[model samples]
Target: MKIENIRPGDIEAESFRIIGELLGDRKLDPRYEHIIKRCIHTSADFDYADSLYFSEGAEERIARGIREGAVIVTDTKMAQAGINKTRIGKYGGQVLCYIGDSDVAEEAKSRGLTRSYVSMEKASRLGRPVIFAIGNAPTALMAICDLAEAGQLDPVAVIGVPVGFVNVEASKERLIRSGIPCIVARGRKGGSNIAACIVNAIQYSL
Candidate 1:
């Protein structure tokens, strides 16, 4: 049966199975696996989309793309995080820089991205036509979308990928309330491994 067709508990089991197939013994530890199992099983509702996480610097690459010309809205952490991949010239898409802190913003500036923003206000001024909000900073992203709707910012598509167990629903619900298309993986499947896997799929699909 399809993943969506199953109950929440069943879906968690299926997630374990799929993750097991893809990741194998790396995540097979009983305790961590049990945590994942419990989280997915108890959370009654969720939306499944390709998700991604970054322990190293995948968020940096994503941020760089935004800075250059990509119309994407991300959390402070993802925006500030730097990209550190061996394959540099592979992602030649778009760049629209939106960041949270001074350090990441400074780094983006060094990369010739002077149009970086530290707040949702900056994101508004940038006027990106499409905004993809990734990771768990929902309230901030919602504020950005609200501004867009209020004519204070350029209107665009708002998507949220809130990784982690914290405020996952509230963040996603904000996106939903804004009448934007938000894609999120179910439950606590918002860690580095799942996040990386989700991004990998997006890369391949794109």
Candidate 2:
């Protein structure tokens, strides 16, 4: 086995170069190139280049919202912890995960609903521009759709990439049809890490 000696700082650049080579002749929109590349870098899976879906003008909307200090809500604490808080804070934005909140848990238990659902409901009342980053629960996506339908919440953008078999595809489909700005992974192949990477990619592009 031969190990190529590459500098630590240049490893990521080299990896991206290889990825670009592997994707030769495949044209990706210049606007979303960073996001697609970042996802592939995180998972070592080129499938993201094909699976990721972006709503029309979603990137511009999300970038503007972030610049204006939108609050980011995630379905899982892992996603919340993975985001780059320092960069978000520079834009006066903050990341929140309500799945672990005691009130959210209690409400979900009392209503026979998942904690993710209750968390979305709770986030809706924040009275500020919000960006949802859901990576672990389809129920969370459903709740957001419901809230939007009811005219109770208007999220700036949604990142729907929950990884699961149970209603995962259905939830993403619902989000796509909701007429909301969104970025989605169109199958059961996402995670908190991927969700965070997406956010980081957007931030890095800014």
Candidate 3:
């Protein structure tokens, strides 16, 4: 038998070095490289380096909004829990998830919509700038996009990364075609944790 020990910081530092090596000569857009890097770090998937897409100036706008007290509205509680709340709070912003709220549930039932869709509808009412982070439920992404297109809601930015076989790719494709500011993961390979990582990456940078 053999035993070895290393400092946690040292381990993480080495891990990042390995991640960089795994990346090789691959190049990201540079503007949103840090955000993608954090996603890859969280998932240990180098493919994210290319899969993640950012609308022009999306990172800068979202970062500035966060600094200026913009609110974060996530589709699921998992995403709310995963984000860096303390950092956002420093700028008087908070993370919200209405999935478990009674009103949201009731509204979803009454409207024949998913809870995530109703959550976005509720979030659209917030007078403050809202950054919708949807890492689950393609219906939610569709709802937000509909609102934005109708000029019913004006979100500061959208982070769309819903994961599933159904409607996931379609919802993301809709966002890409949209003129709104967004950070998205193309295809059907994203989740709440990935959404949180993108938000935290921006928050930590600031």
Question: What are the TM-scores, per candidate, against the unseen true structure?
Answer: 0.46, 0.97, 0.95
Model 1, 147-174: lDDT tens digits are 7578786433433455555666665556
* Runs of candidate 3 exceeding 4 Å displacement: 1-4
Model 2, residue 19: displacement in angstroms?
1.0
C-alpha lDDT of all candidate models, in order: 0.44, 0.93, 0.89
Tens-digit lDDT track of model 3 for 107-179 = 8899899988888888888888999888998998999989988898888899999999999999999988988
- Residue clash pairs of candidate 3: none
Model 2 lDDT per residue over 1-206, tens place: 99999999999999999999999999998989999999999999999999999999888887888888999999998999989988789999999998889999899999999999999999999999999999999999999999999999999999999999999999999999999999999988898989998998998888
- Clash number for model 3? 0
Ten-residue segment with the worst summed lDDT in candidate 1? Answer: 45-54
- Tell me the RMSD of model 1 versus the true structure: 12.8
lDDT against true structure, model 3: 0.89
User: Which number leads on lDDT?
Assistant: 2
